[model samples]
Target: MLLKSIHHSLDELICLLDQVSDHDYTKSCEALSNATIGEHTRYILEMFKCLENGYDSGILNYDYREGNNQIQTETEFAKQCIVEIKMGLKSENKTLYLEKVINGLGIRIQSSYYRELLYNLENGMHHQALIKIAILQFENMAVNEI
Candidate 1:
């Protein structure tokens, strides 16, 4: 069920991409602090990539993302990354570890692969909402409804 939700979110992202022109995709919105929709989409994809890498290595670090610029500027590249992320999520579940700072103290905690996937799903949706707003502001089109 969680995987299905992630897939659906990614599909919605792709649908939004399909509806926008390349110029619009790269257009930065002043209301959004000059952040382009492509940049938001790229950040979402990289977060999933970080989870996938963390799932394999047992350590999930959001700071270690590759931050591929191609994924930001090219819709096809972003779509490919989404496909790769879905393929990675199909692997067997495993225990993952993450570090967090609590009151300025760093601590490591055990986590599950599925839970990280859920985090990525939610994170992706949050960015998607931002992207939807940028789309509305710049293109005057609604996305992710159908």
Candidate 2:
């Protein structure tokens, strides 16, 4: 059952890619991976870490490792900032840490939703945000109509 589910997921993902144009596919894929969104909806997600010794002794600052085949020119500031945010979770303050995690998730969700909207707008998909909204809002709108 698990393997079947995995296979179905892969097939669905491939079909999604095939349905969109090259540009929309690329944009949506990158937006999925990139927390730092772009275009009019420039939503930058925090990494939950802080860089620079000023923030924390363990926080990495300007230590761009090489030969690991990673993004060569990663933003050190952003990386550190994320680290700092993560450190906050380790603190005794549960409420604060939970809030940070929730906010981060919300930001990620909004970015992807907007990306989907943008891709549909660009690639001439059937529905933009309104279509997606309607589908979500639909109650027993399926063929069964129960």
Candidate 3:
């Protein structure tokens, strides 16, 4: 049930991306201090990828992620990443170790794959709300509410 909701959120994000022009997608918004919609999208996708990596390796570190510029500006690349994420989510459940840096200290907490997936979904939605605002303000585009 959680996976289904995450997939649906991802689909909604993709649909929103499809509606925006590439120029607008990459355009920096003053409200966000010149952060583009693509950047937010990349952030959201990378979080999912991080969760997947954690599930595979038993250690999830969200602080360190591959900084792929293409994932930010290229819509198709982001779409591909989404597909990979969906596939990963459908895999067998496992224990996940969530690593977080709090007050300059590293902490590890045991978590379940499904719980982490829920985190990713909620995280994506938070970013999606920002993206929606940017889209509405910067470009005359219709964005679906998440």
Candidate 4:
């Protein structure tokens, strides 16, 4: 059920992307505080990437997840990333550790794959909402379809 929601969110993102041109995808939106749609998309994708990267290692640290600039600057590459992420989404739910650094201190917490996946899904949705706002700012694009 969680995976299904995640996939649906991803599909909605793809639909939103389809309506956006490369120029607009990378263009800064005033409504988004000058952040590009691609930037948000990269952020959303990277959360899942972080989870997937740490799934086997049992150590998830979002801060250390490598950022892929290409995914943010290139619409096609970003779409391909979504495809790859969807393909790699399956895994048996198991204990996982989430690591984060705050105020110069590192913190680790016990978590599970499903729990992290839910977090990613929620995070993606939050970004998607921001993306929707960004989409609305464009006069040329039909934002209602998304």
Which candidate has the top score in lDDT?
4
CA lDDT of 79 in candidate 3?
Answer: 85
lDDT of each: 0.83, 0.25, 0.84, 0.88
Candidate 2 residue 24 Cα shift, in angstroms, is: 0.9
**What TM-score do all the candidates reach, one by one?**
0.88, 0.22, 0.90, 0.93
Cα deviation at 72, candidate 2, in Å, is: 17
- What tens digits encode model 1's per-residue C-alpha lDDT throughout 23-141? 88899988789999999999999988888777667988787789898888888778888888878775567888987667988778899888888888888888888887788775456
- Indicate the worst ten consecutive residues by lDDT in candidate 2: 36-45
Q: Tell me how far candidate 2 lies from the true structure as C-alpha RMSD in angstroms.
A: 15.7
Candidate 3 residue lDDT tens string, 62-110? 8888878988998888888888888878456788788899999989999
Which wins on TM-score, candidate 1 or candidate 2?
A: 1
Answer with 1 or 3, whichever has the higher TM-score. 3
Q: Write the per-residue lDDT of candidate 2 for residues 1-146, one digit (tens) a residue.
A: 32233233323322322333333212322323332111111111111121112122332222221222111123332234333433443321111111123534521112222232233233322212222233333243321111
All models, RMSD in angstroms: 2.2, 15.7, 1.7, 1.6
Clashing pairs in 3: none
Per-residue error at 146 for model 1, in Å?
9.7
Model 4, total clashes: 0
Error of 2 at 16 (Å): 0.5
Model 1, 26: alpha-carbon shift in Å?
Answer: 1.6
Candidate 2 is scored at a TM of 0.22
What does the lDDT read for residue 16 in candidate 4? 80
Residue 16 of model 3 has an lDDT of 82
TM-score of 3: 0.90
